[model samples]
Target: MTKSPRFMQIKTYLLDKIESKTWPVGRRIPTEAELCEQFSVSRMTVNKAVRDLVNEGLLERTPRLGTFVCQRKAESPLMDIRNIADEIKERGQLHHSEVLSLKAIKAPEDVAMRLGIMLGGDVYKSEIIHFADNTPLQLEVRWVNPNYAPDYLAQDFTDKTPNQYLVDNCPLSAIEHTVEAIMPNEMIAQRLDIPLEQPCLLLHRRTWSGDQLISAALLYHPANRYKLSARTSL
Candidate 1:
């Protein structure tokens, strides 16, 4: 296995602390000198870690001011799964999507385990940027278990939402969702028309049909413009 770099490891450690709330938002982190001593690395290494986190929107730095933990944005609920087109229609807005990529690829280890398949199993991947009223809303990255949806790549995603197509073609039993807050990478930032330092809401979902995993998806949305909601009953 390829080990992460020293700077990356440091970044992960700091991120874990932030995520675990050890260092809450608006709280200043250890000074550069302090971190260099704690990690037993040079100032350059510590600076790199901290700089990357700032670029990733996990930390904020001011000139002459210390670096502080960033506050997590209020996330909307995505408890209920809905088609993007339907969502926009319900809100009386125009919905559009551009197909970025659609092809078959070998599933990676993480994706394979989630789909309950071999690491190199065949899977269909689709990437699309969903828009509302000409403004980018979400970046939809999906992997379909070909066993369930054989012709997944042949459909015209520009005309129909993937959720709509799946609902029409595949029988679904249950769906799993994992939502998180993250900073957009260069690619995602460019696609979503947001700054790389802006935070984004990531929704990772897996759909199952009759005990079989059907699809896994990563939905990315700009935090400032997009919000999700869900209703639950006791």
Candidate 2:
């Protein structure tokens, strides 16, 4: 296996200290000069590591107050289909979600076609914003075919992740995923706490179980802070 880069190693070391409370929130970390001495690396490398961490919301630098350990932001692991809550917990962070909207509504033309239902047919619509350490990470907009997965709207998403609940109850037979990078709109920007100009990765997915369209969802994540990778066997 290839070893991790030195910059990444520095980043991980800082993050581990923060997560372990060795560097508490608002605690000033060593200065760049001090870090350079400690790590025996060039100032450029230390600057790169600190700059990346600041961009990632892991460290806050003030004009003269210096850099301090930021409150831990929630982190999500890249793994095979797993619950977002579980991902956050694995990182030792608090997970919370807010239901921006949840109701039964008529599907739009495109959504109806995707779900194989009439444009005016009833569909359970839900919009949720997931938070890691109180920072929004994902904006989820979903539509459920009530005929296949009834009582979807009544479930408590705070206690159980939608993916976990659906897998356990609906047991999809096939899943389709489409990913793209696009600029986020004002609404999505507010929800994800990203600048409107910042690009976001939009993941559109549809699932089927026993020939029935089970669910369709759109997941949005800030581009600079989030990434998705996969491996396939041919």
Candidate 3:
């Protein structure tokens, strides 16, 4: 076969480094001039290649900070999805997270329908426990649409909550929230560091960008440890 276009060659070169983690998440990539010099191609071609990767979520650009290898700001609990960190900061308490699990799994029927993907489609799932002053505050269980955030599985959420990451990386257009009281299961109770008999508050939230379902989450908080509040403006 004939050799591909210079831009294609350039794109593939950068993609290889990213996938192999040579350019890890949040690692700043070379500038257009740098790539132009390396590939001996015009700046326009390099820019086109970089722009394509950015649109694919493989690269991200900041106004003054330069482009970096995108981390796929996926689940791993956009760490402050519950705004737990901010709440703790406001109270002058230290905060952190216990990431229970992060992986890629085939979506079940109900989850697929809610995420607007076909059954068995790829989805990113994560479980996390948010802490306030070293006390468990909430257990966040989330499923993310892979299409919206293609590198979802490669993200490192140890330092941030899924909600915080997504909010920063992906622009959201809509949200639906529901809250109810329930007795958490054995696993959830243990993660929340509470007894199964204790009632828990479940916040089921579905987020979307326009008509596309971006993610669905179940935030479970111990009734005694946490309270739910809402604000409204008329």
Q: How many clashes does each candidate structure show, in the order listed?
A: 0, 0, 10
Residue 28 error, candidate 1, Å:
31
Ranking by TM-score: 2, 1, 3
Q: Write the per-residue lDDT of candidate 1 for residues 1-234, one digit (tens) a residue.
A: 999887888899999999899999788999989988888999899899999998667788977989999843323457767787777767667888999999999989988987889999998999999888787888999999888889898999989888888888887789988889999999999999999999999998999888888999999999866666688899
Ranking by lDDT: 1, 2, 3
TM-scores of all predicted structures: 0.67, 0.71, 0.63
Candidate 1 has its poorest 10 consecutive residues by lDDT at 71-80
TM match of model 1 to true structure: 0.67
Top candidate on TM-score is 2
How many pairs in model 1 have backbone atoms within 3 A of each other, for residues 3 or more apart or on separate chains, i.e. clashes? 0
| Pairs of residues at least 3 apart in sequence or in different chains that clash in candidate 3 | 77-161, 77-162, 77-163, 78-161, 78-162, 78-163, 78-164, 79-160, 79-161, 79-162
Off by over 4 Å in 1: 1-77
Q: Where does candidate 3 stray beyond 4 Å? A: 1-82
**Comparing 1 and 2 on TM-score, the stronger one:** 2
Global lDDT for candidate 3?
0.81
